[model samples]
Target chain A: MSIKNFILFLFLTAILWVVTIFGQSNNPTLMSQWIFDAYNKKEQTAKKIKGKKVIVVAGSNALFGIDSKILSSYFKLPVVNDGVNAGIYLPLILEISKRIINKGDIVLAPLEPNMYSYNHKVGVQVIDYLFARKPLFFWDLSFKEQFYILWHIEFERIWKGYNYRGGSPLTAGFYGAFNIDQNGDQINTSLKFKNQGMFKDLERHHKNPEHYGAEFSTEALGWDYLEKFVSWCNKRDVKVIFVPATLMKHPSYFNDPIEKEFYDKKIIDEVKKRGWTFIGKPHNYMYDSSFYFNTNFHLTQKGKIMRTRQLIKDLKSSLKK
Target chain B: MLFNTYQFIFIFLIPTVIIYLSIPREFKIKFLILVSTIFYSLWSVEHLLILLSSIIINYFLARKLENSILNQRFLLFAIISLNLLPLIYYKYSLFLTFSESSPILPLAISFFTFQQIAFQFDIYKKKQQVKSFEEYLFFILFFPQLVAGPIVHYKELIPQTKEKNWGEYQKDYFNMGIILFSIGLFKKVVLADNLAPIANYAFANIETISNYDAWLGIFAYTFQIYFDFSGYSDMAIGLALFFGIKLPINFNSPYKARNIIEFWRNWHITLSNFLRDHIYIPLGGNRVTLPKQAINILITMAIGGIWHGSGWTFIIWGILHGLILIISHRFNWFKIPSPIAIFLTFFSVLLLWVIFRADNLSDALSYYTILFNFQAIPINIEFNEILLLSCSIIIFFLPNSLSISQYLKAKPKLHWYHSLFVAILFFIALKTLALAPAQTFVYFNF
Candidate 1:
């Protein structure tokens, strides 16, 4: 390169470095609400916690008000919400391994059965959880885990997931991402069950029924990483609950088995056999199919209220236990 | 990856440049081609199959036709058809099935297909020789120009493939890689994305829009499509130049054309040339009677219009342009000075573009009704966005490429520091894409 060109390259490189470092904080259009809410809460948690027992209800759409943000308000505890939009199994594992997930946090990590293949929802959310999470983060991952990350990036949309609409906001940017850190009284609303996105959700789910697994057993959810996740949680000293939130009140195509009946039953038996608190039910919070987001397993607004009410009511006794 | 993405600009382009700059002259073309293909195919491997098939069919057939005598012309038709099959499949299928449902994979199948068709023609006419399949395929799928194109010919790109020279590595790398990329990036991320909202809002709810909004939307889209398409072309050309290959320029301030004929020649010049050479001339050119020639122009443009997309609006767009071209050809309204003629041509094309950019025929009618109906709906001007929209219009009308092309030919004497200054400005412009997600080149779907 010419001396002039040399100067130019230097200038551009400098600009990029400066921007990435400073400008990433106020990034608008962080489309997935739960992920944004998590980032909001994570930033908040980083400010609040020293060595707090943060019981996180982390999963795709499982953060915000329903999990740590709201649950903390109910219990008067400080919990870190590692909730991300479409937060599946591997990313959660990677996040936990990276120390974005803290230890001694009573994990209500929802056993999302669909995160079998590492994929979709713009791997940036995955990157944000994995790499964007503050470090003290463990550095090592198994070859399969590392390969899954790369493989996920490569085959994310094509074979991995069913998100073809390309990051259209199916829920409000304000799906209750409010955080109240003022005084002892607190309020934050992140409803995982929202129903307003009925048409969009249905269209998307119909296009790619990611719920169905490669091997069929009448389960709509792709149980790719469920077993591994359960096993992973079993080893840790974390107080865990395997709560499978379903809008399906009974047997149906939309609300799958609590884990194929056999698998979910065995896992529940194992968790109980191991003395961990495992509280869940088959189609426990089931509603009409209309209550769920038109497609996939997300809940709509009205659905969120009903589901959240039922969940908080059910989990209240468990909290006391 | 999108030209706008941080991944492409930072992750992909930066490393590619470093690798491209370090490579030996002989290895550079192969190395760059391989990397560019991988980058291009990151979205899906299926596209590669389509690309490879087109190249294979074209390459072997070109070789066969070159050596054979019996039924050579027919053989040429078969070869061209085979190459175009995927282009037809991917590009036209959705349009063809607009009433029904159809599937689409992200691929710039038309561009490669059209380029190879050009190559096939060049071979048969003894204008260009049949080369190795690798060289032919590389020309067809030269990553920069692969999707949206200047529709490069084999003659220009083939020589670069054979000749391994790296004398201008730095100059080409910085200028093409950094400078051209920055310009293209600015056009896309900053301009097109900015214009997108206004254009989208206007088109979706055209009937509800004011006359001012309609006009603004019409012109905004005109600029948006130009910048979006031409920006992609520049990016493609820039990418090719990094590997020491030059591709043709596709746009030439099309808004400055004096007549529809000149406008087509200037705008999407390759497509115009293809229609004129393949469709127009073969149909009897201007060699027939005047009215017949006018009909020929109409038919040619209709096909060309439909070539842009499969929708009725595209068909109408072609017909409108075809009518304009015929009217211009017959009337001598273009006999005025270059500026006036250019003005007339651009205004007509811009009006036609309203149809081209519309969601459908009814949407086009609604937009045009709102645009020319003179009934002003209450205009809510997002002043900053409106200003950007108008600025894009002014810049779109600015004849940058012809001047740039001329300047390049002249090889003007310039201080090294001036080049340095341009590089800095380029970086500032390209900075806009820093936060933007990777957006596919708009024409890539075609």
Candidate 2:
């Protein structure tokens, strides 16, 4: 083959690659589509609610952790849990929350610790979610971010998405869109108190309390976007209350008081400085491992009730002040 | 710094190739040596120093062996020992002492050390000579084949450095290199890496895995090691072709061989040849009594095994192969039907690979027990079944990379479809690389 022909071959391949990226971008997978459907349902619910509603926003921790119906009854107002997968980009989550939150609404953010320290780089999950829920949002991204997404998109995911037979969100069972209630809280009975062996192993492995929690950085990419979200809420006269995500109460945290104090101080100081109404201490929300469903963050059905009662108590105290 | 990485391809290879091709022909070899040094340094400057020191010491000692007459045999032994010193210190000291900690093994120490020893041996035997310091350096330090090699000899590579009319063949070589490299990259990133998870999961969960899962893991590894090593070898040869240098084909569909001897002949051919010439032949290969020859084979194979790693499993894997080779030699297995013979040989190899892949003898034994325990438990582990099937089909029915390269070489004219096929292969491999962390070639540890 001539050098010219070789270059031509390379040119042809580059064209095919670009074509593939565009082609795959339009076709989202069943999992992402299901997540998108849940988002749409939650957005509709938030829109339906009238006057002084409560909007619970975070990652999956908030979805499984909060009892929005109980909170709605307690506050004498509609409550919408707008939390989804934490793996989604933090900024994108905040942006999604921005659309649902209204004037005079209270925003309860019990975000996962890791969310505060998220690196701004685009990951596969973020690409999948954005492509499914709001592809136009992808165009709004910087060229570097888009390139990062396209580069990291696996052939397996694309192939699976292409070959995926159309299925209802119910096919996803426990974590399906169907499991999410009218207020966007995940309420599957099967996930009530199932013993997760993996969490046991995780607990054993993370005996040192030092391994837990994110290293709080005020200048983190997450914090910058979070500040923007708070500003957006503040502009609309929407009250923002920052609370810690529900955590497993490991004994090591009690043993290592210094590490515990450091962990609490970093987050509390940041939240206070940001002018968000910081509610209940993180340690107060740390329940026994039995309260956790699978991961350390997610709560079981009974655990969610306990967490909601605690949140209500914390809110009552703050609102009274 | 691995051939499979984006940084190696984009930063190191492309720039180096552009500079190399544009340079004057007389300066090309020197330029390659410099780039090769840079490549090694990128891996570790300390290791590069170790490599350079080895080259200098071996080169001077080789010259001494070539010139000195009175104590020639003593000097040759001394040179060989001196060459083995660093390899032993870095690679085998922990094994020798049964200790927990040891100095880091320099990358490709086994490969370059063996190459240097062979060159020294060749010089002593008057079969080869180092014409120039630059030529010798370029031969040993040539980047593509330096780390994981086909173990290029002084004769195969050094003479190629002197060739000047490579400009005429530049396009053909580059095209062929691309095709070969694309195939290799696909095998590595797509096949081997994808299969790695299944094998790793099963091995890591050996105590809990069923008979079916155990077999799946073993088969996954059986094909994984072949694809990983052969893929690396193909990439090396393909990369070398870009520079108009042809490294020897290290693999030739060894799975198709009907016997252990033929398997060895086809698998890692350079290493097998090196063992035969340097170790086996020097130990009175086939010229002695049958028992003595058997002992020779055992000793040679054990060394070959240990050369791969300092682990007892590697040594045992080698000794088992040596025993199998002895049995293969003593009996006329040729009388057996060819299909059955191939199956038997493949089965034996598959079993041996367990020993090779295992971290320890105990794990290997437990794995064997699991394979034969006949426990019919449901398969709990999730793996790419389609990929495993595809790998099997490719291994059994598809033409190996050498055959494909040879076929490409023989073709009179290249067509558009051929380019498209190569392009698609390259594109898929590149995207796969983008999706995951590039896995290290399995043989690099050796």
- Superposing all C-alpha atoms, what RMSD in Å does each candidate have to the true structure? 9.7, 3.8
- After superposing candidate 1, which stretches have Cα over 4 Å from the reference? A1-321, B21-26, B36-40, B81-106, B161-173, B206-212, B333-342, B377-380, B387-390, B393-436
By TM-score, the best candidate is 2
Model 2, position A261, has a per-residue lDDT of 62
lDDT (Cα atoms) of all candidates against the true structure? 0.60, 0.83
Question: Docking category for candidate 2?
Answer: acceptable
Instruction: Name the regions of candidate 2 deviating beyond 4 angstroms.
Output: A2-30, A33-41, A69-76, A119-124, A171-173, A176-182, A186-243, A248-291, A300-321, B98-100, B166-169, B330-337, B375-383
List the candidates' TM-scores in order.
0.64, 0.88
Top candidate on lDDT is 2
Positional deviation of residue B432's Cα in model 1 after best superposition, in angstroms: 4.3
Could you give the interface RMSD of each candidate, to one decimal? Answer: 7.8, 2.0
In CAPRI terms, where does candidate 1 land? Answer: incorrect
| Candidate 1 lDDT, B1-446, residue by residue in tens | 67667677679877987787777766766776697689768867886766776667678888898988889899888887887666666667767664355556556666677777888888889898886665665676666777677877778777765654542464644454545555676677667776777778888887588887787777777777887887777676677667667777788877777677777878888878888887899899999999889889889989888777778998888888888888877788646988778677778878888888887888887777777778645656665356565665556555474465455446655356545645654554454443445556557655
TM-score of chain A of each: 0.54, 0.84
